[model samples]
Target: MSMNPITFTPIGVIHSPHKSKEGTPIQPSRLQRSSGEVEIFSEFRPGLRDLEGFSKIFLIFHLHAMQESQLEVTPYLDDQTRGVFATRAPSRPNPIGLSLVDLFSIDNGILKVGGLDILDGTPLLDIKPFIPDIDHAEGIKVGWLEDKTHHFRNHQADDRF
Candidate 1:
C-alpha cells in the first residue's frame, strides 16, 4: 500500500425528506416513495452531461452523521453480532454509504431521484451510472443475510449503530 493518506472532497450534497438518522430506511430498495435531490457543485456540473440517459445511478456518499465506528456490530435485522464488513451498518471503519437510486430527471445541477434512504445533508463522494449488464447477477449467495432480508421493508433504523 502507498504510505499516503487518501482524501476526498464533497462533489455535492444530498437533500432528502428524512432529516434524521433515527427513522431512515436501512436500504434504498425498502423505501420506494422516498424521493430526494442531489445538488452537484457548480464546478462539477459538466460531469452530469451524459448521466441523464441512465435510468438509475449509484450515489456514493459519506455518512456524515455517524458519530463513531466499531469493528463489530449487531445489525438492524439480526440479533447476532457481526463483523462490520459483513453488514451494511452505518458505523463502519469508513462511514461511506452507497445507494442505487432511480434517476427521474436532471435539471441544472440537481438530480431528482427515488428510493433514497440517506439523511438530509449527506456529502456525496461520487456518482456512477448503473448499467444493468454489469451491475446485476441472476443467482448469488447472500451469506448470513438470506433470512434477514425479508424483514427489511418494514424496519427503520434506530440508534443501535
Candidate 2:
C-alpha cells in the first residue's frame, strides 16, 4: 500500500490565553470562561456571511504545537492507553482539533468566541455554524467512553499527551 501527502493552508489563527498545552482544558465544555478570537484571513472574510445567527460555531484547527504523531496514546484524562481515534489526544495521523464555541460577534474578519480549549496561535482550518437540527442526534453511542463520561466534567489536559 502507498500513501499520498496532502497540504493545507491555514485560513486563520486562533488567539487564546492557553499559551502552553499543560493545564489547558481537554475539551471546550470545560473551558466555560476562556475567551478567544479567530482572525480569519481577508480572503475568507466572505465565508462569515449570515453565520452570526447561530449561537455556536465549530472551529476546526491544527494542533500546531504537537511535536509528533502516535497511533496509540494515553490521553490526558485516563491512565490507560487507547487508540488515537478513541480519544481527543493531539498526537494523531492528522493533528486536528475541533471545538464548538459560543459565537459572541464578528467584526470584519475577526470572530469573538468563548469556550476555547485550543492552544494559543493554533492554525485555523475552517469554521462551521452549529445547527442543532442537523448536528444533534436523538441517541448516540459513545463506545468505550461510556464508562469515563462522568469524569470528563473535571478533566483537564495534563502532560500525558
Candidate 3:
C-alpha cells in the first residue's frame, strides 16, 4: 500500500469572534447567536451563484493550529478515552473539521454566517450547501453519542487535541 500526497489552496478565510479555542463552543448548535463571515476569493465568487437559497452550508476546513494526530482520545464532555474516529476531536489523522453553519446572507463574495464552532482564521477547503432532503437521514443510530447528547450544548474543547 502507498500513501498519496495531495495539496490544496484555501479559497478564503473565516472571520469569527472566536480568537482562541478556550471558550469557543464545541459545536455549531451551541453557538446559535455567534456570527461569522466567509470571504470567498474573487475567483471563486462566481461559484456561489444561487447559494443564498439554502439556509445552511457545510464548511470543510483544516485544523491549521493542531500539532499532531492521535488514535485514541478523551473527548470534550466525556472522561473516557475512545477511538479518535468515534469522537469529533480536532486532532485526527486528516485534521479536517466540518461545520454546518447558518447562512444569514451573502453580499458579493462575503457570506454572513452564524453558529460557527471553528477557530478564527481557519483555512477553508470547501463549502457545500446543506440540503435537508438529501443530507438528513431517518432512524439513524448514534452509537456512543447517545449518552452524551445532553452535554453537547455546554461542551468546550479540552486539551485532548
Q: Per-prediction RMSD in angstroms?
A: 1.5, 1.4, 1.3
List candidate 1 stretches off by more than 4 Å. Answer: 30-32
TM-score of each: 0.94, 0.93, 0.94
Q: Write the per-residue lDDT of candidate 2 for residues 88-150, one digit (tens) a residue.
A: 888988888999989899999999998888899999999988989899997788876878776
Ten-residue stretch with the least lDDT total in model 3: 152-161
Tens-digit per-residue lDDT, 78-145, candidate 3: 77898999988888988899999999999989999988888899988899999889999999888878
Clashes of 1: 0
Computed on alpha carbons, the lDDT of every model, listed in order, comes to 0.90, 0.86, 0.86
lDDT string, candidate 1, 1-161, tens digits = 65776799999999999998888888886345889899999999999999999999999999999999999999988888999999989998789999999999999999999988899999999999999889989888888899778777667798796
TM-score of 2: 0.93
Q: By lDDT, rank the candidates, best first.
A: 1, 2, 3
